[model samples]
Target: MLFNSYSFLFAFLPLLLVSWRLAQGYGPTGLALVLLAFSTVFYGLWGLPFLIMLAVILGMNYAFALALAAPEPEQAQPAATTEAGSEGEAEAQAKTESACMCGSRKQGGCRFRLSRKSLLGVALVLNLLPLLWFKYSAFLAQNLAALLHVQWHFTSPGLPLGISFYTFIQIAWLVSVYRGQVTPQGFTRHALFSACFPYVISGPIVRYEQMGQQFDALSPITAENLAKGFTLFTIGMVKKVLLADSIALYADSVFNAAEKAFPLSGGEAWLGSLCYTFQLYFDFSGYTDMAVGLALMLGLKLPENFDSPYKSTGIVDFWRRWHITLSSWLRDFLYIPLGGNRQGRFMQYRNLFLTMLIGGAWHGAGWTFIVWGALHGSMLSINHFFRACIKGKTLERILALAPLRLCSILFTFFCINLCWVVFRALTIEGAGRMYKAMFAGPFTREAAGLSATTDGLAGFAAMVARWLPNNYIQGWIPFALLLVSFFVVWALPNSHEVLHGRRDGSHPRLGWRPTAAWATGLAVMAFLTLILVSRKATFLYFQF
Candidate 1:
């Protein structure tokens, strides 16, 4: 269910809040069971069959891990009896069991060792099979039709909701388990950690180890967490309802018109593209904010997804600022695994390329998605090379000149905007036409697609008929909202810094400030939610 929906916001959330608080008095295990059931119900809203399918997959993954950790017959042999047995074997065995009693107990140690590679292979296969079946089935089917020289079609497979996130979560969980980072915990807790609803649909991708203790225990609902969560949820709601959806109006018109019109003139082409760029940023980031806030309401801390990406001065900085969770996920799970920076310069470049290509493919099953990923990947690599060549000299030179820094920021934004064309376009041809119109078209008179007065000339009348007013305020209120939103984002301290306050034990009062913030946040959010309720809108990334 959508967080923005009335049913979710009013009915479901209230019920959940009451249930969660009541369950909290029981204990962690009880709370986890409650959460697990709640998560399943949330997911089950899609359909009963899909929920069953998801359950089977989750069960398979959990069982696979158990199988990997289970002792084998060959592993039951005493280590001392083996010819290769030595101090290393004894120490390894001790660490595998209980370190405290290994030597003192005077018991023969088992020689079996769990293979990380084996476990990872199983996890990757399990995750990849369903992803391929659902996401790429149509692509493959079309290819097969052409190759066979016959008519053929395939029905689309049932894609479980949040499969994209759950797949990645399981992959990460398996890696942590293989690395021995996972603490001893019951299977119910592990299941809850992986399938928790707030993060499941669109994730900040929580790590298994970070949540291990939270699954075992939780703190009571405090004024501080409530205040912070309410503030975040309110801000996010405003971003989604007021800012993102408004831009989407113009974006939808322009892109829809582009599919039929070969090339668009200035106002429709450029402004439309710009609308999409802004729309996507607010929509995705807004959803993440709400998700984080909701998790906090439940006394769980989810990761932050975005920083101010537009404020970034370079492409490298842009990645660091945008979709932080996904970026870090790619870095930790994919980039580091491909030998990281340790294998020398050439391998580093190779890893960058491969990671980006895969990352692009991850966005969708379409060529447009692939191109979008490639565009960003190439930008990142170029930025790396540019940094190496300039060293500190580039920034130092810019610092000496204010206009230079300004130019750099503008250039970075323009480049990022250019990349968004690939992301927004429905087809590769559509992207090419948009770019052609943007760069090669005439800049004046009728050709520019701006309105021309009759006094100007006779030749201008026909083309000028197509021109639309450029008043920013009349068409897109959300554009104005974005201006306010950006001001707010810049006004606040970084989320990580704000989060640090909660952990550092700095705010000792537990008084009115927290309560006031929550109240204000809730009021603003409720007001905005009411305003946007009439328009049915889907989350931007839901298409992917």
Candidate 2:
């Protein structure tokens, strides 16, 4: 199901493009049908049961909306002389509140507006049902078993592919429908919007209204968009195939064999941990880039997800830079709903903690993830407290001084790396052991795994170990390359600058030099792909 796989990239994408473009010649309806068929095939690849579940939910939502939009019986008024002003006021109030879509409008005032309360009830239940089933079924079952003292064993059927994404898309759609933002684009557009294969598994979470415009627009693909699209697509492929995947191997080797992965000195463990952190960023973000790039090629502009987050000085700054779409989604849908900053101080903190806790839970069904989220939420809370105490004074003064900035940056990286232990660990116990080992002792040669005593485990130690021999030197080379790659990504220009209309963007003007640079980037990417072809790796985010 990964977009990077040979089956998806070479087989599925090509087949879909040909069929879709061919069908588009017929009309919008034909195109919609083609997309729906392909999307179903893509989803059905996960399992037939998932497809059935999806269909049932889609049907339920569609039916519920129709029912909500059905006309309500008029309330009988008492036979009393009403003032002219009162009658006019009632008419204006009705107009203000009633915005609905049911059947076709007639010459007189149409009765289409639904009870908002009823619509809300159906939307929340229908939209959240799948999320609860897929994400928390095991957790819920465990709690229920404990409560009832039942002997029933609960085993989780693995999640439906892209359930997280499709769930979010459906919820957003239903909310928009309830809010009178989306006119019914009919069934086909709704289906396509919910299950667009390119972005369903991992997403920029393309909104309902956004896709509606694209579905209805008569504009043909322009050369300018095509060029930008192809450029983005090529760059994304390079990032995923070459850079991200390459770094991941070293990260895996080290983390997987934590206790025995050489004599992991404090320095070595820190280096390895940081490497994994960066590896995850690139791996997940690279997949997102490819998704956005692919969508763009199809004339859809999926939102950007990351900036140069590593460059951020604070946790708040890091969150803003990383996973831009998800953070924004959580803010808009969850945080704001919980009162946001408009509420008093205690409530604001409550909302912040709850938002992050839920956000963490959204990532996975584990206490470790909850801890990871709590760590971030705590950092944010402390930062907020400091801001209030500091008044308008800048932390910039401290950061402007070289020592303070370096110390804080290094501390921040270490803190984030420590959190990754929880984020990456196989279990809570594994994380606890890793933490204990870090402070347990000084550098030693006792710890051993593959390439354990290779002497090139730590970069500084590895540099010193370079004069040792063949296997040791060879292993160190890959590690060295990984180190260099981290620095490159860490120092890379801000992707957000290019994504937004910021003056200082990562991409230069699209002149001949820039075009040549892109070509070089493509070549580097192809070489990376060749390296990775021998070892297929799943993207890190697929678990989420």
Top TM-score: which candidate number?
A: 1
Which residue runs does candidate 2 get wrong by more than 4 Å? 23-30, 67-115, 142-152, 258-268, 394-409, 441-474, 494-517
Query: In model 1, how large is the Cα lDDT of residue 65?
Result: 68
Model 1 bad stretches (over 4 Å): 70-116, 144-150, 392-403, 444-522
C-alpha lDDT of residue 28 in model 2: 68
lDDT tens readout by residue for model 1, 1-544: 7878887878888887778788877877667777888888888897898788777877888766665554332333345755566665655555555322122433465344344466569677977899889878887787788889988867878666677777888888777766667643567766788878888877877888767777666655666687677667766777788778877887777676666664466556677777787788878888888888887876888876787777677888888888887788899999998987788767877788788878888877777778878877788878887777677785657644868766777788889888888788888777776776566544455465455454455545544544443432244564565566556444554444444443455642322254556577568767867778667587877655
lDDT of each: 0.71, 0.68
TM-score of each: 0.83, 0.80
- Which pairs of residues collide in model 2? 260-449
Global CA lDDT computed for model 1: 0.71
Checking candidate 1 for backbone clashes, the offending pairs are: none
The model with the greatest lDDT is: 1
Tell me model 2's lDDT, rounded to 2 decimals.
0.68
